[model samples]
Target: AYFKEKGKEVIYDAEHFFDGYKSNHAYAMRTLQAAAQGGADCLVLCDTNGGTFPFDIFKVVQEVKKNFGIKIGIHTHNDCGMAAANAIMAVEAGAGQVQGTYTGFGERCGNANLSTIIPNLQIKQHYICIPENQLVNLTKTARKISEIANVTLNERDPYVGNCAFAHKGGMHIDGVCKASSSFEHINPERVGNKRRFLMSEVSGRKTILDKIQEINPSVTKDS
Candidate 1:
């Protein structure tokens, strides 16, 4: 009512109740229905306990969609190591948007990793939201948010991680040098990430040549 008085839409986070109790499909359904009736723009189902499995999430999401004809969103935590999977299941069940922290950093195991979710949605699922050019800005946005929060970035994060585009194996580096798609699922440039060829026990001549060429294309092996 307050929001409506102010001419704004209301959205229930639905975190507190889920965190305090175990999985209650009935409660979730009732809450969603009530929110929809209350004029909510979207109903966000939060796996605050972080104990729900992918299949369970799918079931609940599907039921909610059948019950309410409103838009659905998902908020998952990483406590059970299935946050990403549950989020994907919610989407498959017709959830339109996913909400989470940047590097899965939060109060507990952290929220769903947007870095992983974004790539999974765009590359694998082929869903379109922002412009292709703005896709690269996703990484920049993550870093900026992390900086503001004074949190260190994770190196192993799927698409936006520092090492996400790094190649170390001899065969992998060779293929990437010739054609990035040879070893990479998606071009790093597409996400504003730079491909790195790390020199070590696995480094090969092709890797060296590629790095050198990148620095100075005019210089050849003889030069």
Candidate 2:
């Protein structure tokens, strides 16, 4: 009402209102509809405490979209390890935008990792969320944001983490040697990430072969 009184657009950050606090989908739907009818430029659904599964999120988001024709957005937390999945499901259910902190950094577990969401949407689902050439800049963008916030980056964060594209297991490395798709669902290069080969006790000849091929493709596997 304040924004409307001022003749300005209202954007509500309704994250986590759905966690375990309100288990009623019907109520949620009604609330979102009312917000839209009241003149919200966009309706944002949040996985407030995280922990929401993809299937559940899909069901709720689909209903919201069906009931309200306004723009939908998703803000997910990383608790219970389903932030990325929930965000994706929201899109599938008709959400137009995704919001999250880079590298999933936030209060508790973390917010959705935009790095993972961007590539998954663009490469896997063929969503035009980001420009094709600019995709590679994702990692740099995440790191830059982390630097600005003065937060330490997680090495295991998806897509942009130091270890996101690293490989260690012999069998996994061998499969990647034949084809990166064998081990990685999406090409690391697509997200400005380079493939890594880690040698350890579990490393084998196949691992070595794959690493060699990755380094010098001219060398045949038989050699």
Candidate 3:
């Protein structure tokens, strides 16, 4: 109320909100009501311990959105490896904003990975979280940020990971050869990654031809 009277924006964050809501639902709602009555500009629900499941998050956020007329946001951690999923669920249930760290790196188990969340929300869910032109720079930017932070980016991280689009074995390569969509979720080029066909014990003639065609597009099994 004091800040609102002074015309300063106040974003009240409800930390450990998930646990609090689970422990005492009515009390939690009352606390949020107090913040709203005090003129909070926005209310951010935080999963401070990062242990809540996605379903629980969805339910709580849904109820909050229904009761509060203010902007709702989500802040999650990755201790349970559900940060991105929980964040996405919150958005689905009506969170207007998502709080996360780029490349999913932060304290303890880290925060919700914006790298994963951005693509999932933007490309998959059709939300406009970033400029359309900058969407292609996701992988490169993640790498640069990881390098600067001296944190080795996980090669298996979703969307920006090196192995995210890599295909191996003869059948896998053959499926990808027949149709890029067969073995990939989204195009690697769309996010500045590349499709890799690793040579494996199962590599077949079709796989070899596919590799050769990379160097010489005209070369084929018939040729």
Clashes (N, CA, C under 3 Å) per candidate: 0, 1, 0
TM-score of each: 0.85, 0.82, 0.93
In candidate 3, which residue ranges exceed 4 Å CA deviation? 210-219
lDDT tens digits by residue: candidate 3, 148-183: 999899999998998999877788888887898888
What's model 3's overall lDDT?
0.92
Enumerate residue pairs that collide in model 1.
none
**Candidate 2 Cα errors over 4 Å, as ranges:** 5-7, 19-27, 205-223
lDDT of 2 by residue, 35-63 (tens): 87788988898888887889988887787
What is residue 93's positional error in candidate 2, in angstroms?
0.6
Instruction: Please give me the total number of clashing residue pairs in predicted model 1.
Output: 0
Candidate 2 clashes between residue pairs 3 or more apart in a chain or in different chains: 16-48
Worst ten in a row by lDDT for model 3: 202-211
Candidate 2, residue 46: Cα displacement in angstroms equals 2.1
Query: How much lDDT does candidate 2 score?
Result: 0.81
